[model samples]
Target: MAWVYLIVAGVLEIGWAVGLKLSHGLSLAKPVHTGLTVAAMAASVILLGLAARSLPIGTAYAIWVGIGAAGTAIAGMYLFDEPATVARIAAIGVIVAGVAALKLVS
Candidate 1:
C-alpha cells in the first residue's frame, strides 16, 4: 500500500516534470500544463502522506526525487531529444547511488 503510493508519487513526479517542459514557461500551454502539473503535485502529496506510514521521510524522499530525476532525464533525452551527455548519465548514476544508499542504511 505504501509502496503503491510511492510508485504513484514517482509517476506523478514524472507527469509534472513533463508538463513543466510542455508548458513553455507557462505561456502557450498554460491551461493544459497547469492543470496537469497541479494534479500531479496533489497526487504526489497524497502519495507521500500515505507512504509516510511505513517509510522514513529521508529514505522515501531521496528515493522519490532520485527516481524522478533519472526517469525524467531519460524521458527528456529519448522523447524530447534533450542532450544525453556522458556527464549527465554519470550524474544520474550518482543520484541513483545516493538513493540506494539511503535504502541500505535504513
Candidate 2:
C-alpha cells in the first residue's frame, strides 16, 4: 500500500512536471494549466509523505526524484519532440536502475 502511494506520487510528479512545461512558466494566461500543475504538485507531496511513514526518508526521496526525473525526460521526448538520443536514453536507464536498486535494498 505504501509502495502504491509512492508510485502514484512519483507518477503525479511526472504529471506536474509536464504540466509545468505546459503552463508556460505558470503564467496567468495559462491559468488552467497552472492550476492543474499546482494541484498535482500538492497531491504528489502528500502521497510522498504517506509513503515516508513506512519507507526510509532517504530511500523514498531518492526513488521519488528518480522516477520524476526519468519519467519527465521520457515525457519531454515524446510529447514535446525533444531529442531521443542514445545518451539521454542511457541516462534515464541509469536513473531507473538506481531506483530499482534502492527499492530492493529497502
Candidate 3:
C-alpha cells in the first residue's frame, strides 16, 4: 500500500540522515559510510516514488519529511546528547504545523 511505502521511505530517510552524520562528512571511512548513506537515500527515493503514485505529492512529501525530521531530532537529542532546548522544541512545533497546514490545504 502507499502508506506502507511512505512509512518505509520515512524510515530510510532517517537511516540515511544518521548515516550521513556517521560518515564524518565523508572523511573517515569515506567509501563505506558514503556508500551506505547513498544506498539508503536511493531506497528512500524509490519508496517515496511508489507512495507518490497514489498519494498527493504535497501530502506524501510533508508526511515523509515530518517523520524524518522528528526521528532525527529524537536521535540527536538522545543518541548524540544534543541540546533539546525550548527553541529546538519550538522548531519541531513549527515543522508539525507546516505538515498540518499542508495536509489541510491540500
Candidate 4:
C-alpha cells in the first residue's frame, strides 16, 4: 500500500536523522556509519517518491515529516538521553495525532 511505503520511508528518515548525529561530521564519521546513513537517506527518498505517486504532495510530505520528527525525538531521548520532559512527550503525542489525522483524511 502507498501508506505502508510512506511509513517505511518516514522510519528511514528517522534513521538518517539519528545517523547524522552519530556521524558527527565527515571528519569523525566511520565508514560503516556513513555508509548506512547514506543508504538510509537514499532509500527513504526513493520510497517517499513512490508514495507521492498516489498521495497529494503536501499531505504526503507533512505525514513523512511528522513521523520523522516524532520518531527522531523519541529516539533521541532514549538513545542519546536528549530529554524526557513531560512537555516534550506531550508535543510528540500531538504530532503523532496529527499524523494519524492526516492519514485518515487522505
Segments of candidate 2 deviating more than 4 angstroms: none
1-106, model 4: which lDDT tens digit per residue? 8899999999999999998888874334477777788899999999999999999998999999999999999999999989899999999999999999998999
Candidate 3 vs candidate 4: the TM-score winner is 4
* Poorly placed runs, candidate 1 (over 4 Å): 27-29
lDDT of 3 by residue, 17-90 (tens): 98888887655568899888989999999999999999999899988999799888978888789999999989
| Weakest lDDT window of 10 consecutive positions for candidate 2 | 20-29
lDDT against the true structure, per candidate, is 0.82, 0.97, 0.87, 0.92
Best by lDDT: 2
Candidate 2 matches the true fold with a TM-score of 0.98
Top of the candidates by TM-score:
2
Residue 26 in candidate 1, Cα distance off native in Å: 4.0
TM-scores of the candidates are: 0.84, 0.98, 0.81, 0.95
Give candidate 3 regions above 4 Å deviation: 93-106
Count of backbone collisions in candidate 1: 0
